[model samples]
Target: MDSSEQQDNLTESSGCAQAALFGPFQLIMKDGAEVLISNRRARAMLAMLCLAPDEPIDRDHLSRLLWPGRFEAQAKASLRQCLSDLGKLLAAADCDLLDISRSRIGLKAGAVRTDLSDLHDLLTEGKYLEATERLVSIGAIPLLDQMNYGEAFDDWLSVHRQQAEQRLQSAVSVALSALEKGDNLSEYARLSSLWSVRHPPAQTIADRKQGKVRIAVLPFKSIADPADHGFFADGVVDELITSLGQVPQLLVAGRTSSFQFKDSDKPPSKIADTLNVSHLLEGTIYRQGEQVRVAVSLVDAESGFESWAYCYDGSLDDMFAARAEVVQAITNGLSDALKLTEHASQPRKLTSDRKAYGLYLQGRALTIRAIGDGVLPTAIELLEKALEIDPEFAECWTALAEAEINMTVFTPCLDRLERCEKAAGYAKKALCLSPQQAHARIVLAFYAWTQNDIIGALDLAFEAYRLEPNNPDVLNRVGSFLLYCGRSRDALPYIEASIDQDPVNGRNYAILSGVHLNLGNIEAAVEAGQRMVDLGFPSLWLAAALAVSGDREAAIETYQLTKKLMNTVIYPPAGSAPLNPDAMDAYWLMAAKGLWSGKDQDRKNYCMVLEMLHATLHDPCDSTIVLPAIWMGEAPMVFKTLGTQITTANFFAFMSLWTNAEPINRVRLHPDFMDFVERIGMVAAWEKYGWPDLLPKPSTII
Candidate 1:
């Protein structure tokens, strides 16, 4: 055969296989001709198998997913028919796509290529910009578009997409950071240039002449053997950060961001620019026999000058005392250099036992990373072990509480109410151990919010923020709560402060996006949302913000791609327990319809669902159900819920939503609302926070 004919034959033998589910479920093949399958179930089955290429899915699980409401026998029979049809379809297309057996099924290894697989590969290779471009190009493709497979499948797809988006987002962030530092410039120039010009990062500390004193404490260098003294070196940096973070006027970079430069050969000036810190602290630790030696210095970001230097020598047994001494010296030096009063010359010690303190530091580090899904239990174990070593360790208790709350709120692997109860217990114990513990206060604030004690929650959140002004965790928590409660303007400064302290943190960007969205700063919100995606903390807020900001086409596209995942989790199918479906529904309506434009019937249906959820579940607060009820014109249901809330001292919490003008203002005319509001001290809160403009003028006392 001629060369042209041979090339054609080779092309025909390399049968094309296409699979994508980000928007629509699309699967096809071509051997010089396109292959089409008419059966929807067959197509869905192929997609499912292809989604987990090379991993065998049990027949029972596949049956349940494909026929959620069917009996086992009937479901398995249906699955068999689908598999047979899919096998024949692939064979006709000249593709070897399935590996089916009596007990298991999966896509044939190396025989198929999928968008999902390609996206995952890009993320794994750290090609964030490429991954992002691929995702954007997919443009709101729904997972298995419009397929009625069942809620089981829906729920799985939701989590699957969420995870994928998170990976892509993380890649974006790392890529952007790399670009900023002149790494892989030519390779990622397109993404870097586009993102840099379109969504410039928050101004770095080097760009700002005046603000809170920003600082980064670099991980200490270890001169001793790697295994024995490595933890000691880390412990010192962690301790110093904790001690420095107590100063209200200072902004301390989080360990995760600062420690990224451990053993880095980059100059101090370069490190400062990368970390966005005006000042840097460098240190070294060396342990030999019974003696421990430490050396440290502070550097000025702009001048690249060493401002101060210190060395400490002490017995390894006296490490805690020596640490206290060193901390006092650093704080004094920093206070002098910054022209600010030192909050305390000596930082408060967490634990007197050096071994216990080391364990606590280890646990603390783990908990910081525990914010990611499925990682909380590990942190919880470590924190609990640390507490066991020193039961009176108030900080350990607080850490445990924080981890429990994260597991409950951020992950769906645990019983939420149970986790909440455990979190409250830990927080209370921490408070009892040390009444001034800021983290415990924040945990209690979360408990208060859950219980519908909005007034108490806000009070606690503010108290925690005030106590630990430089603590990024507390700053973000307070800011997030304020934003959620319709105090976006008030929340902005706190959120910005957190970003200043932890500029590279994905969580900080996420909060910034929410704050911007709440303030109706569309461009800022979009930029922040994109930054979050870049940072690999994918969330649905960006799409909602775009929708609310009048970018209908983009919003709809994003929504279509994410709706299944959003819906599965927000409006969970029967038999699954979501943390708070009522709240999720309220959030969904707000995100999808600008919080103010749901159809009357849609609102009513959601209100009904909310009522059912409230009745069936242990809802400590009325706020979740009340807003949706009010939004949907279900005045009677709202009033009834408020009545219960008032009786339970949750009235203040219900009134918390009253500060949100767009929805709350519209409900003031409900005859029963004003009477309930007066009885619940709404006037006092309004006086303090300023009244929502649409509230009725002061009328006759109820």
Candidate 2:
């Protein structure tokens, strides 16, 4: 046959040839014979083409990447020779897979199939279960294993490998979510365990099962008018959960999770199962005028049998004693029923005055809700009034600190550092009054983190955890601090545990999203972000997660929603104008810049608005202005900002420098990174508490 006829015949049979790039590189012919390409550059070029399948890659770009240091003419000449050799090799193997042109190169359409393409097809078809099974069977193997062409090629390979892993993880996340929605618990557990093997939690299953008693205290049903007594009932339940969490052997479900069942129709057994607890404590409260009555029962979750029961009647005037009696009775009953040692420590009352306690409860409720315009300020006012009535109310002080810390973010018009400093002061006062207040410690830890005191922040967070291991807020805070310090693997277990304990709290999910994003679980991050939004908390972090997940439209929508929420928070109807208009402008500008930085197609349109906003801001350090530059991978801008920060000893917005995002990773890869970390005390922090995952150990940092 002639050459053209032979080519036609080869083309007819080419569909049978396949490339496997998920692990080792393989080129299989029609007869399932492996055709070896011994040339390393040829193999890399083939892998690159296979990555994009039938899409064209610029010939110049390919040459530059593979022959990075060569002159343009020499590189192109080498590329042509490499292509000729590769073509001859493929022809010898009876495979015709290249679609070469003068300007571009790509794999021939329908000429080769890849394992990655097959996996993507399965994912596109929504065969998540099959995709997950296939991924598990494939295991945690790197793509194009042991192929290191050069620095440029290695960087390209690293990005592609990460993308591959992200795609697989996204499939797993989708499968898990589907299984959960379908109520397929057995399959969910099996799949979750398998996935967990690849990305292990900080605490192992054995560590979680170390002879601990798990219990959930449900919010008491109110028999009185809810509007008048709901906060009191919630307060009592909150206090009970807090007290129970202090027991050494107890693992109490968080108040947010327990309260999720306050109006639930689910039976106690089901609620207990959902909370992953062996026992459930539930009750009813009735109050009329100054009189109050409480009735409670503890049930075995598995058997659905009542293990203990109690009732108490007391005046509202003696609320502290009444609450104490209820807590003590439950603890004693639990000890007897479960054969556990009784905790001897008594619950500390926050305030002696009844009215002060009432006001504190109301304010705490509003603070926890954290929804509407002026809610935080109103909560602050009520809490301050409570403190006025009883200046030594430690819990009230902690609550005030929490509110102020929240205002640092939610109230854009306020001075950010001023709020943080105020929160620190309140936290300090609370610690002086009650040294064991974990909430106060958490607040102080957050403040310490803002000031870039990594050592002090971690110490305070660890102390808070030791004080109340099962407190969900404390767990989330500690996890957040760890994440900020670039200890994502160490942060994962705490964030997951916090979510398990407080599943309904949007804030917990928000932190979980950050942990997942830093760990490179894009789909899980987006899912967690969506959950936060579904729980009525629109977040810029959610928008960022969506953008990272490649859902640009959804990300833009979320960003718009966040702006609206911020507007409401800053310019509430009937509320005073912003105390600092520039601060407000700075806040909005930073958010806009973040959104703009993530968009490739929208940048041209967004540039004008960004410039306008930038022109309006007087403070150079305002709005975390360097963050957008970092996100855009502008190393010079980042270095310049850091230089100023280092000179002034003020590192505003440097908290996120340690994250594992690609932009931050690129910054870390810069030649000046070691010097930067040393100057910023990150090196010292790493030496004290181990190095971050992305950075090399001190000895290796030449």
| TM-score of every model versus the real structure | 0.55, 0.63
What are the per-model numbers of colliding residue pairs?
7, 0
Segments of candidate 2 deviating more than 4 angstroms? 1-209, 225-227, 300-305, 539-601, 604-615, 618-630, 634-664, 670-680
Q: Give the poorly placed runs of model 1, Cα more than 4 Å off.
A: 1-212, 222-231, 246-249, 254-267, 287-291, 336-343, 372-374, 559-702
Worst 10-residue lDDT window for candidate 1 reads 196-205
RMSD of 2: 17.2
Model 1 Cα shift for residue 348 (angstroms)? 2.8
Clashes of 2: 0
How would you encode candidate 1's per-residue C-alpha lDDT over 123-218 as one tens digit per residue?
Answer: 567767665565434422333444556678888766665555555556667765776687766556445323321111122212332556888999
Give lDDT per model, in order. 0.63, 0.69
Across 343-383, the per-residue lDDT of candidate 2 in tens digits comes to 87557647778789889988888787665678889999999
